[model samples]
Target: MPLFEDLPRDIQLAAMENAARTTLANRYGITPGAFTLQQYEDNCVYRIETDTGPHTVRMSVRDGRPPHHQASELAWLDSLARAHTVTAPRPLTTTDGTFITETIVEGLGPSTVAIFEWVPGHAEPPFREPGIAEGMGTVTAQLHHHAQTTALPDNFARPTWDAADILDRGYALTHPDHPLLGANGAAVLRAVAERIHARGPIPERDRGLIHGDLHRENMLLTPNGSIAVIDFDDCGLGAYTLDIATVLSSIHRLCRNDSEAYADFAHRFLTAYEKIRPLPESMDRFEDFLLLRDAFIVNFVTSSTNTEVATWGPRRVAGLIAQMQAHLAGDTYPGTLTS
Candidate 1:
């Protein structure tokens, strides 16, 4: 009986799988035939096999959001599904008709678990691929459109992802201070955050529910040529441009070696997004949001307690800081086009 963190990798996974199975049987009444761990870093994500089909079960060990936040995510997903907008993963309730289950793992303490009917699709091609970036744009706009017209339920709750939340008060940079970033890197991050704050308030019309982590990996390409968005764990109230910047910054990092390809991808994405909804106002400050996206990643990586993930934190934070420094110096942020 070792503490969860002290257990060997395989042993920890076995314990998690067992916990998932037990939870599924007791809560959902679906005894799974197979269970596979899909992600092990920030959260424990599993692919469970059932007679009907596959479904995904997520175990949130450190989730601190209120119950309303989880409810808010499922509500939006249901709305998008019914609206026939972009395909969103539909959540399943427990046998008790509750959306969330409070449970404890053998080694770990309390955790929040939920299940989603497995989204039917595969990962999309690289952003450099033609039409791929455009598809991301179209799907993002579809979500924004739904958010704009729909009325939020009175009980709905979510975080507001603004410059201060993501950057100025980032978990890694400020929570006892990240060792790798030190003082200078922290200053660089604060400088960018200040510029974003100085841009003034976001228009009422420009703020809405957004997929705060809508990068390439969160998207899937279905058989019928539709883009399916997954992982609503980070959904929140934010400026629409923040979502756009998330997508653009992902492409920029992936295509860092090829400026031409990055430009092509950015052009295609923005052009297609405008076709759906007018680009969020104040896009001149779009690059600022892009830097914010990088800061978000830095916080995510450095805050992880997982040893494997923490091992990569330094290098990852370093790379992200380099990009931020370039933006701070007024040099063209990579993959950003002035035209």
Candidate 2:
């Protein structure tokens, strides 16, 4: 079992793409062109057309994760869909009667893959249209509300996004100490960690099943003109603020310190979020979660074998650190507003 990193960059990507296509053709018994490859990096996402119509297939990602973690995601996704609080890509069981199964990608070895109904429609541009935030907020609140009320199966298992998770990812962001992080960046990381520590344990009410990576790209504006979420692979139990911050995190990057634009988004989302579920008056924890998400990405990109992410990671981390500094100085550009 050769690790993805053991191979050179070009070799790693070529091998993955080839393996993905082969896995679909062989294990899934799909012909060539049945699945159009949408992404070829950490995971190979394809728009698959089958006898049952259209679905998305994710394959050729990290093979290291245990299969049960994937099963837990499917369990919750099915529950969310049934509850009608939010629509997620429903998992389709494989020929073998299991939703989450493994496929051997020849030279790449065994990799976990699953099929999901393609939630149609393009990604809503972050805050491009007025009231989009309200719609997103309403949907998020519904998701949280449902999560709070639902009971899980006794055997259900999911990871926690906590001190341990942060520590696990911290090394990747710190190692070789990229020139981008520099001295100020290092200090900011330390201060943010301390602030998070001072908050004590996250309150139970503020923690539940969250769409752990709920950025614009992972969203779909369905034909019914509703916001549908996709890619729950990162879904887990965590701070409710973490989920809220994930949405704003992408908007923050897009706004690039434009306080007015960021404030508009914050106002709309908070106003609507509170309509369905209570949102805290003080959004001070927003910036902390933003930093946490950024740190996670830095670590994610660092570990990825994808050439593009490897090149972009350092610069993105540096930019986020600078924004965090402005936030500490009371700039509070994006997620710190009230309507």
User: What lDDT, from 0 to 1, does candidate 2 have?
Assistant: 0.72
lDDT of 2 by residue, 290-311 (tens): 7678767755655566666767
TM-score of each: 0.94, 0.85
Superposed model 2: Cα runs more than 4 Å off = 1-32, 167-169, 173-187, 280-284, 325-334
Say which candidate scores most in TM-score: 1
lDDT of 1 at 183: 63
In model 2, which range of ten residues has the least summed lDDT? 167-176
Query: Residue 184 in model 2: shift from native, Å?
Result: 6.1
